[model samples]
Target: MDMAKDLRGRKALTARPLRLAAATATAGLLLTLAACQDGGADRADDGQASIVAPGRPGEKSRTLTPEQAAKAKPDDSPNAADQSYVQRMIEHHRQALTMSALAPERAAADPVKRLAERISAAQKPEIGAMQKWLALHPAPTAGSGTTAPGHGHDHDHGSMPGMATEQQLKELADARGADFDRLFLKLMTAHHEGALTMAGEALAGGNNPAVEEMANEVVATQSAEIHRMRAMG
Candidate 1:
């Protein structure tokens, strides 16, 4: 009986280390997960944030200090070009919405009405996105020869490419039936062309990835719509 008791005690002692090793591993895993949740960075015992920068292909990732991470970060901040593009595009889209609004009441062709609906549906959400982006990343204070990027603050809508003249808009508003259909298709086609030009300029000058993505979407969507309009015409 004493021998059996001694063996049992040995087994318990052997299991303790295994259980302790498992607990330590679990704690380490939890710490690693906590670090990942904290923005791909880990906090040291001293409470300093440490960045985990991934290396090139076939290379191992290494830790970096905050200063190093900042230095390594790409210069993707929104520039004046980005701000201007977004601000102007918002106005541009509003004009498109205005034209589209007229279609439901005046358009004679089913295709024209459908096209107008599509334009409104696509552009409204885009306007919301751009507005949200602008709100999130406010423009810098105005300086010499520059204006703050606010709605209608400094931009002249008439001067923007593809914007219909006030006379043209008035004409569109007055027209009905086939006249409205012809005019809407013509004006929207031109407006989309203008959007393409603006997007190209943004792609060339803007530094922010968000601006680039928005510009690319404009180019792609407008280009397709332009083709469809041409075929319709």
Candidate 2:
């Protein structure tokens, strides 16, 4: 009886290890299957492939998904109103720069000279920005060849409102001392008003977001400058 008991005890111990091993293997397999299912779900949630899209000629490239690309609008292709604003504003800003350039020699008051400098500084950068925008979307007049560097086009200068006539510019150029200051302020104020008019038109009719942003900036800055120039006078 004792020998039979020992054999049965050993057999029970051996069977216990086999059962534990089987349970551990089953648990491991279940855990592996669970992990695989979670990984598959994660992949499904983020399955869209990334693609690089080209921007406007001078602009940086952007990344988008297939869905985003499908919904995206082509804002870079400028409309007729946008092109008109750019072309006209370029000439307008150039004339302002011409007026501002006379300030150092012609303006008598220190404040007037400083104001002219400020105007020149502000408009130069804006002119460059507009020119760059134009370069990206060339005008119909622009041949297949590269567009010229500055606002050197043959557009009619008198067509824009608030521009000083040739007689007025000549008068401003010839004036001196306190006379120059008063005339400078007056002419610049008129020029700024014209810019406001153009900007308002752009806001109403222009289609490009960039042009609209520029117009809004012109309205704000030129409006403030107009008030300041009036106060100076």
Top of the candidates by TM-score: 1
Please give the lDDT score for candidate 2.
0.72
Q: For candidate 2, what is the TM-score?
A: 0.66
Assess each prediction's global lDDT (C-alpha) against the native: 0.78, 0.72
Candidate 2 weakest lDDT stretch, 10 residues: 1-10
Q: Which stretches of candidate 1 lie over 4 Å from their true place?
A: 1-66, 144-152
lDDT of 1 by residue, 1-233 (tens): 23223333543443334334544544444455467676765777777777666554586866756566556545567878888899899999999999999998999999999999999999999999999999988866556445445433477878889999999999999999999988989999999988887877776666777887897788767877888888888
Give Cα distance to truth, residue 178, candidate 2, Å: 1.0
| C-alpha RMSD values across all candidates | 20.0, 27.8
Q: Tell me how far the alpha carbon of residue 217 in candidate 2 is from the true structure, in angstroms, after superposition.
A: 1.6
Q: After superposition, how far is residue 116 of candidate 2 from its true place, in Å?
A: 0.2
